[model samples]
Every structure is written in C-alpha cells, then in structure tokens.
Target: MAEENFETGDAGASQTFPQQCSSLRKNGYVCMKNRACKIVEMSTSKTGKHGHAKVHLVGIDLFSGKKHEDICPSTHNMLVPHVKRKDYLLVEIENDGSLSLMEDDGHLKTDLNCPNNELGKEIKDRYENGEVLTLTVMTAMDEEQVVGYKLDNK
Candidate 1:
C-alpha cells in the first residue's frame, strides 16, 4: 500500500486536491511542473510491462499563460488546482499600480496590482478616457491575475 496525502479545497486555505490521473477531463485544472494550469489536451496509452496505463496532459497556466506537460500512470494520483474567477468594476488605478476595484456586493478590493501587460495598458487607457470597465480576475494556487474584461452591451 502507498501513503497518499490530500488537501481539501476549503475556504481558499488550500488551493489544490489529489485525483486519479485517468479521471481528469479536458479543460479541467491540474498542477503541471508545480504550476497551476488549465488542461488543454490529454491522451492515454495502454498498460505496459512496467505498470498501469499512462496519461499525457498538456496544460496552460491560468495566470502567466505558460504551457506545461506531464505524463503519469493512470492509476496514480495527481494534484488538481481549484480555480475561481470574479469580475469587478474599475474604481481607480493607483499610481503605485494597484487596482482599486469594486465588487457587485459593494465590497472594495485594493490589493491586486495592475498587470504590466497589454490588458493592463488597455484598462488604464480606457479608464483615462472615462469608460466604465469590468475586469475579470482569476485566482488559483494562492495566486491571482487579471485575465480579461467584459464588454458593456449598453
């Protein structure tokens, strides 16, 4: 018998949990090479003389947009990360680069930094032009980043 360790994704304290490699589905979250990623593709191989069937997975980082791949036995367990996304109205972009965001529930968050990417530049540009912006932020594995923005239909 093998000793297995698992963490429950409770209250955001823990960000990942263990699941059998074969049970994973495409587009689900997985930990690849120590980075939390979104599975983009998956494949399986037949059982071999060495052990159980093998599973191949390719994933992209939810935060940094990096690619990672891993192979594991179907019967073995792998860590799957829990990902969450939220949208907030842009209140202000501090000179220090932190974003002051307001939630729909009237909560204010000022800890997230404005990313130094194209999206970040766009956010600042639009805000300076007096446009209301809704930013999408994704959180996982104790990390958070701006992923995208929502377009106003009105």
Candidate 2:
C-alpha cells in the first residue's frame, strides 16, 4: 500500500502531491494565484461523490475596476497577488463638471456628461472631490506624454 501524507493546519488541509487536489476541493480549500485580489464571490461545487470537488472564484481589478472569474485548481501552486498600481492622480477639479488627472506621462480632462457631444441626453454627473475615476486610456501615447485639454469651449 502507498503511504499518503495529508497535512492539516490553520489554513485547513495541505496536500503534498498533485493527485490529492480532488481531496483539497472537498475540504473547501481554493487555490489562488493572486493573494491581493479582492474576492467578490466564493462558490463550491456540489458534484463531488467521493474525492472530486471544485470551487469557483470571482474577483475584481482594483485599479481598472474590471471583473473576472475562474475555476479553482485542486492542487496547484498559488502565486502572490499583484497590488493595484495607480498610474494617475486627481489634480485640480474644474468649476465645470470636469476634472484633471495627472499621470507620470501627461494630464487628461474630459466632460463625459457634456451635451451636444454625444448628441443626446446628459450622461455624466458633476465632478466631485475625492471621487476616484478611471480616465480614458490613450494607448497610442508613451508613458512620458503630458496632456492638457478643456471641458468647456474656451
């Protein structure tokens, strides 16, 4: 008979081999590649009969504010989660409903809710202080580029 070693501790159970992944899933242990991810949802599978189980995870990007989901691995190595990096900073807030964002390369300002541009109803709310907004991505420019524009016709 083959000797199997299953380690259990404060983190639950620890399996030293790959075949033991099914067991880890049954015990409610989900593997994570990015520990820094903000877990928005955690769901377990109800299909396990003896030693087959799985977990699902849904997470959001702290920087870009995007959502993503994936299946949990049974016995995989977990990597450290990358921290959300802020490439831009909120600078001066204009009198109008627009604001300026300063990054390492440039400045960006826009009135997303302004009328006559979108050809319809107003979409953007008036800019406010301490509001973290995701600026439009200008992939064509380099990181050192600085941008300056006006919200209203000036």
Candidate 3:
C-alpha cells in the first residue's frame, strides 16, 4: 500500500487529480468508473478578509503518484459497472444482528447483520412498520452494496 503524503499547495509544485472513490464498501455501491488520482493535502488558510471556506481537491497519477498543482475535472463521465437488479426477502434477524435474505431462487441466506446492539432498534422499527418480514436486493447500479427493501411489493 502507498503511504498518504501531505503537502502545502505551492504554485510551482506539480499536482494530482481527485479520484472518486467509494465511501461505502460492503454497504452498497460499485466503482462504476475508475481513474488514477493522486491525493493532495488541503488545509484551511485564512486571509485578512472574511469569506466562505473553499475546498481544493488535487488530482494525481495512478502509478508515480506525483503531486500536481493544476488539474481539470475528468472530461468523461465515469462508467459504473453493474447489471440488472435482483429481488430478495428478509427471513430473520438473529440476536447477533446478522440479517438473512431469501432469494427468488428459494434460498435463505445471511445478507448482512449490522451488530447485536444496533439491531434491537431496527428490529423493533421493522416489526412496527409491518416490515417485520421483508426482502431486499442490491441495486443494479450499485451491486457491490446491498439494499434492504420490502419483499411484499414484489
């Protein structure tokens, strides 16, 4: 793994571009598009005049990881890789908070159990909402992550 580098923005220095990375992992979402981007360090600098804060994101290369000062947004939209959305059902939520989802193929399997303590609140909410039993599936555009939804609607 490459170490995160920190630096100040100097006019003469080289720069890197900002890469759109996943904020969610197993939760849901996919790397629809990917590009090499170098991480740039940013900090708040105050001028004598009061003004709104501004954000500066720098982009860099995938291999060398050299920092650049000037960059333009990617001209092309990123393509998210995905397929058709599938449906599933919620069979049970264990005391452990792990969730089991039933597939259209008649298979009941664990999808994701949040955590034991965290599940009590959700279980109760689901029970009250008439969603005690349900199904869910990953959206086609974001298959990397799973989305829990009602199975009855299907």
Candidate 4:
C-alpha cells in the first residue's frame, strides 16, 4: 500500500473561534480555563427574571487531560478551539527525548519531544524493538502533542 499523505484539509485553519455557549455539545472541542478541552457534559439553566439562560460545561483538557468547568450565559460567546489531528511516520528518536517524525511529504520534524508518560515509554520501547510506527499528533489552541500511535507493517 502506498503511504498516506496526511493533510490538514482545513486550509487556512485558525487557532480558535468565538461560538455561543448554547450551541456547544458533548464530545466537541472548546477552550475552557484557558486550555483546549473536549466537552464531555453540558447543561442549561433556565433563565431567571431579567436574566439569560446559562450553559454549564464540563470538559477535559485535550493535552493535559485535566477536568475544567465553566458557566456562561447562553447568548454569550466562548472560544472554541480548532482541533486538528495528523499522522506521521516515525523516523527515529533522538537521545534527548525528541522525536524525528517524517511528514507525509517526507519532511522531517524534530521539534516535538517524546511525551514524559506511559505512551512515551511505549514509543521508546517499540522504537527500540525495531517495529515500524505511525504516530498521531493532535494540535489545538496553538499547542501540539502526540496522542496515539499504531504499528506499521511497512
């Protein structure tokens, strides 16, 4: 099989956009507590006298996996993050815990570091074992990190 060229598809993608709180739904990306998060639960409070309806949101940080909650007026706007994911072929791992990943077009990116967690340990272990790996990276709110990986038969 030919190598898949991962594309952004979202041409001219921006970091974030303003969206009304009432429109957000579960499993969607949002910016809460100044972090990019995935909306897990949402509830709406009835509007009281001389007040607007309120939306309560519970989300998990996309990068850190920490819970965050926020409440906003239904009609008020909140920052919604432009979440993006891409897959890259692993080329090599540097001694300093950096990843040498190859873009679909064959350009090597060496900026991202190996995650300091179980996944990072797994990546290191598999790389050391000489298994081909494909890594999925997530980018949002101007931040990027490795989120998952798969073994490659190539």
Model 2: pairs clashing at backbone N, Cα or C within 3 Å: 34-81, 35-81, 105-145, 106-146, 107-147, 113-124
What are the per-residue Cα lDDT tens digits for candidate 4 across 1-154?
9976558566666788999899899999889878999999999999979699989999999989899999999999999988879999999999999999999988998889999999999999999999999999999877999999999996
lDDT of 2 by residue, 1-154 (tens): 9975565332542222132333332223222443223457766676566554565766654333366566754444433222223434445545563545666667454432222233111223323433343433221111111122223322
Candidate 2 similarity to native, TM-score = 0.31
Worst 10 residues of 2 by lDDT: 139-148
Clashing pairs in 4: none
Q: Model 1 clash pairs?
A: none
Q: List the candidates ranked by lDDT, beginning with the highest.
A: 4, 1, 3, 2
- What TM value does model 3 have? 0.38
**Candidate 3 residues 86-127, lDDT tens each?**
655666667766767777778777756533343346654675
Backbone clashes in candidate 4 total: 0
C-alpha lDDT of residue 114 in model 4 = 90
Better of 1 and 2 by lDDT: 1
Query: What's the lDDT for residue 24 in model 1?
Result: 98
- Of the pair 1 and 4, which is ahead by lDDT? 4
- Give the winner by lDDT: 1 or 3: 1
Show the lowest summed lDDT stretch of 10 residues, model 1. 4-13
| Candidate 1 accuracy as TM-score | 0.86
TM-score against native, each model:
0.86, 0.31, 0.38, 0.88
How many residue pairs clash in model 2?
6
Going through the candidates in order, what is the number of backbone clashes in each? 0, 6, 20, 0
Candidate 2, superposed: residue stretches over 4 Å from native: 1-36, 46-50, 82-154
In terms of TM-score, the best-performing candidate is 4
